[model samples]
Target: MFLVLQLAIIVLSFIAHEHEAIAAYVPDYSSLVFPIHKHTDAAKPLYSVEIMTAYVNMQYLHANFLIDVDAPFIWHDCIVQWNIYPGSCPPDKLCTSPVSCDEYQCTDVRTSYSYQKPYCSPPKNESISPGWGYCSCSVNVVDPVTGSCGQAKLNYWDDFTVNVSNGKNVLTGVYGVYPYAACAPSSAFQSFPANVTGVMALSSSPYALPAHLLEPLENVIGLCLPSTLSTSGVLFYGNSPYYLLPQKDVDVRSYLSYTPLIKHPDSFGYFIDVNNIVIKKRSISIPANATTKISTLDPYAILRTDIYNRVIRRFSMVTKRIPPAKPVPPFGLCFSTQSGLRVPDIDFSLPEGKKWTMSAANSIKQVTKDVACLALVDGGATSEPAIVIGSFQMEDNFLVFDLENSTFGFSSSLLRKQTSCSNFNFTLVES
Candidate 1:
């Protein structure tokens, strides 16, 4: 079920009223924090970053900022129906394939292009008509739902600024917004304004540094996503203390754990070294020289059925001491407990003797009052065979992606503590 949810990407947008620039961005000792909220309607424990857009009306949008290591630029949903110019085409005539424009009685308007070109002024002698100029070039937009690609008319917002605040300190950055077909359900769409910035595309966009991270200004950022529904977390720029526990905060610079971030040349997904799995103190044997691949720490933990089977087999072996109940349809291992049962701890052994242990709360799910099912799911036969540590496993942990240093850090979150994260001080140590 989690795997299916990962494939169904639904893009969303929001509208806000326009506002004046607060003040020049100052990098002082003060930190800017944005509250992370959970989408209750989402199938999985999805998180969103609340941001303000500098559209005509000053709209607010929730940007889904994934810890995607491979993304090159930030992406956002723009207003396609507005009928705006996309700038002039390149000298090479590398515009997207031309589409029919009845108003101009011409089919030369390219609807999609390999990359968005810089906005250029129309030639003085050039005649302008509705959808008849070089500015009509299109952009390649991906449908979050079906993973299909289509063309959406392009328009550029020179004053586009996304405002991120934690009620005290606010941070803002500019972004290029592009419109795509609404992928969210109709009911959800009605809740948002008719004209809103649906998405704040970040990570990988054609930029030397990620613009969303206040690129060229502040290169460091940290994310602490809470796993529980009752609590909220913080996403901040620059360095601060390790958010080990909300109630008991620790300086990340003082005692933070470090791991080398493995890079995949062809992808933007963050990958890490995982040696083996240990269930109930017993190390499960993996095939020798099995070409262990780095599993992406994605929002969804998707394990290939083959690997899921191996992990479950070892899990079953350790739990053989308990009475087995009927197995759940989707989940392979499940049990019926009256007084509750003790599920063994599962650990993923990393290099340098470092181990990430999964607590029972993260490894088990209460499907019913009497029946509990394993939270892990099969990736099916065709899914990526590599292991993916999804958001479920990352709950209750402060995940820091230090792009400036090219490293990743993880520590326990301040569980259930609700406080302004801006007040906390963090040490900015460049890796």
Candidate 2:
């Protein structure tokens, strides 16, 4: 009656008739393997040179989200945890012999997973302080093996894989770089008020700079001294050469403004594959110039089979009315059949009296017809869920949507003509 749980589960591995690709629920984004490189300055009109040292060398990538499903012989029992920190432990004091202590002079340790040996080892000390923690995984299919709806759980099908690193380099640099000497020869380098906004390189190392960084105070470089400088970088005055009118304006441009740098891809460039990733059932195909394509039946080909670890997601909380052991997170993946999953183009951007309504049990589900299509032999479409649209924000029992890459498709004749589909299961109402 209230099920919206995707605590965590990813175990990807496809490679034989491969059909699984529609990711970006925010996992495997170590900035997509450290990618953000933009440094512009049509010759320093004001300044733009970002490279705060994010070259994707792993300050983080603890990985683990494996999905392997062929559904002919289901055998799931997932629960994995290893949010370790003892420096990830490996200093060899005999490896500190099973010494785990987090936040109690030990500093953090949590372990889970029982399908016989999923990986767990936390307890050590010698200075371990890194950051970020959330090792919560759960899976339980336990007996349901009857294959043949297109069975193939083992020739390969991976969904989860986690073990990335970089958790401790924290020091990043690059602060706007402004230096046309410091700006204001009336400032012009082509409408260059500065804030060129095309320079990035930040994965995670921000949180230190309260003053004293870039240290140049001799009155801030004498406030860019120019009260008639005689020489020391040219400044002649006389006929045949004189131009001052160019003060495009600057107060640090009101602290900075230049937007258009969505370049976070040192790895997941086309988008996704943090490692053994998973989210199945794809059939993609949407053209007429609206653009969208990705269907070649190679969604990792089930990752070379063996059910890898199982990951189905076409939506089937077991038709239950009481299913919540924990492990739900997926506000996105729904191909078609929960009554044809409706999106109706989703209008009402809001603003003007502000309005949006859809609750009486606001339900929609096309859980999976496996539509991950788009591959006219691979000319376009498959850029990885390039874009989808969604919006929500209702109250008195909440519903909110600020999404990015977008997803939501419903309409199997409007859920066979709604009763709200009699609770097919949807819970985003979060006031």
Candidate 3:
């Protein structure tokens, strides 16, 4: 772990009843919450987005999903066959019904880059179920990394809860949000962690997870990614007043700096403007209109080859005095931590003179007891997205994505407040 950070555990109270309806048991006012867990994979990072969902084989499922802000629609690893099966719907799915091809929900898929129009099942095969045969919605489920896709059909999920927090000490689990729409892929292109199933999409698309869970409150997401596997991060699905407990007086939003979020017509990820990169007293000038995307799927921040070389060159010069350690596999540079080493913070200079500073904890990664390396990697060379901010740098940072106003808010590091993202109080309050 970079610095002192701890994320509270998000307890999931899943309802296993035969049929649970969300509309009957949900409160009008309350911010939905989830605890984010970092998995044990060191080679390729896998952050767990916990959930209980429904599909083909399983009656009930306790699954792990990736929190991908870059994806449009939510999809899972379930097999979907072309021909219709008589008894495909599980009991958990009985709470909600499948969407119809003639419905507006299916038409909305036409507007999405992540989905495809499902050819209406030839008139010969009478409709067995709403989404199965007659004009079902076919999809191209986007993988977070390669951008390649897998096949799936439009599906609705039930059994996901409607737990909410007061942004303080109380988190109450309402009945649940039934019929939340998602997709069922034939096979997930990306590898999963153990029981991992799919992605918790928080993209800008109207079909994302947040879109299905839209409430009467502010359209925003407050997220804190944890740095350590021993702890977990937190998510707030609504506007804030997101409080870090024990020190409830300190609201995480108070420290955020705002920047306009840029949208790509072809992509579903969030993009930001970066004037240049700065290290120590040296300022490395980048293209005037250079932009970068923040990704939860990328384990390490990636810079263009040229930009990465410049950063490593500058860093090497800055700490040239320290003894160098043996090179790690992916990391080009390493320093002997046993002899004591210090790294200068790297800054992604934003417009309006605002800088998204990367603290040493985020700037460097401790690969081994005596070895430490820069937490950045090279993404070949591309000007379209000169940088891709990764999960390693996002740990313990309270990020607020305001979709309503098209803005991105960030808290540099929660450790600076003497608390971590784990400070949220998930304990239930008695009515």
Candidate 4:
């Protein structure tokens, strides 16, 4: 039977500081660290943000925000406010008399809610009535993490101005915030903010806000994702070269490889050139002049079925073969666990001698105790024909997005051992 062999490539250059050594180093002050929350049932990581509410006393609301490379601006679920006394509160909460409150009902005239404390004012243009609001309002919506949506009344706030901080760095900007009732209900979760930006919008994103608002020289953003669930990772703003360097004093300038980032006007995703696919040191066949579709490096990996099949076919040829297991619902290929299969080492070669190597663990998925299948899924007819290098392929790697230079950099993750982000010594000073 064909077994998906798990290939483990031991590269000496990939290993770095031991946990004890890393703990001894002092944290850098210029970067903002956002911890990656790896959900048990989800494939992608969720980032957390502190949402400041303008109550009598400033209250901080924490929400799980998605670092979507595909979205242009910040989208969030906001609690509603009113023009009457005591200002605004969630829809389910009782409003003072004479406010004429009903489910999803506000005065016909659009108005901004001003609080007596004057901590933060609602956007002046927020429509008090229907057809005027930037986003729609919802109630009793089902939460994604917890099944109970609860009594959380959610409304939308466009151009919501808030001072977003990563503990050490503060970013003040107008986010395209919206209402999301189901953003982690057990906790007062509120929004999903996309951090990737183009040359024009770089200053608007939180990652580049320091450069735009505070320090002019600070412009780059770095993301280090741990390969395993046991360890946590960080997202940074400003200068964060420490995470990329293999050792404390060694400079990684000579080792770093960069590729141009292809920006799509209609989408916020990052696209790069993928020259060929190498399996077990063998290059797959492609027409010499055939146009190479620019592939996207997304948080989710979805490959064209044809491309996926071609890869699996090449993968099967060089390994011990076996009859495929009975068809699984979503997976095209599956092998019986009893087959004791092994997968080959796969590498995605970019244009400039840059290669992304994948171990068997990154390419295959275990469907059941007795069945394992290829993790690459068919992109389906509706999907783009281009390849999508998802987060699974990016595990254990440090990804740097330099908007100033317009290039993306990849290296082995500094925290390969899966150390928790909380262990880092850092400080978050208010702006």
Q: What TM-score, over all chains together, does every model reach?
A: 0.64, 0.15, 0.81, 0.58
- TM-score, structure 4 vs. true: 0.58
Listed per model in order, the count of residue pairs whose N, CA or C atoms clash below 3 Å is: 37, 115, 3, 15
TM-score winner among the candidates?
Answer: 3
Q: Write the per-residue lDDT of candidate 4 for residues 1-431, one digit (tens) a residue.
A: 12323222233323434545665665334444455543343333333323332223354333344444543223233334434344364543322211122333322211211111123223222224553334323222222223233323333232222333333343342222222121113233322223311111122233222223334225566655444455455556555543332243432323356777765433434566667789988887533332222221244456666666787788767754755677574666677878676877677777778875666656766778888776676776445635777665565555666767767776533344343233332334434
User: Candidate 2: lDDT of 153?
Assistant: 11
lDDT to native, each model: 0.47, 0.18, 0.72, 0.45
Candidate 1 on 1-431: residue-level lDDT in tens? 88766555432111111112224434333344555554444333455555543333355434443233333332344332223345553222112222223323122212211222234222122223455454332334333222344444433322223433322334353333332111222232222223322333333233212443453234555666566555555666555433433434445444346566665544444556667778977786534332222221334456667778888898888777666677775677887777668988788777787766776755776778788877777878656435667666666555666666766676533332342222332323321
Better-scoring candidate (lDDT), 3 or 4: 3
* Candidate 3 residue pairs in clash (backbone atoms < 3 Å): 6-422, 7-422, 8-422
Ten consecutive residues with minimal summed lDDT in candidate 4? 108-117
Position 371, candidate 1: lDDT: 84
Query: Per-residue CA lDDT of candidate 2, range 1-431, in tens?
Result: 12323222122234222433333132221110111111122221111111221112444222111111111111111111134354553332111111123322112111221111123233223323245332121111111111111101110111212111111111122122211000011111123223321111111111111011122211010000011112111111001111111221211112211111122222111111111121222212222222111111121111111111122221232222322222222322223232323222211112222222222112232123433211011112343333221111110111111012221111111122221111111111211
Candidate 3 residues 56-167, lDDT tens each?
A: 4644456677888876777665533344356664433222344555767666664555433243222121335545455555555655544554555666554475456777
Which run of 10 residues does model 1 get worst, by summed lDDT? 11-20
- After superposition, the stretches of candidate 2 with alpha carbons farther than 4 Å from their true spots are 1-105, 109-118, 123-431
Q: What's the residue-level lDDT of 340 in candidate 2? A: 28
Error of 2 at 374 (Å): 4.2
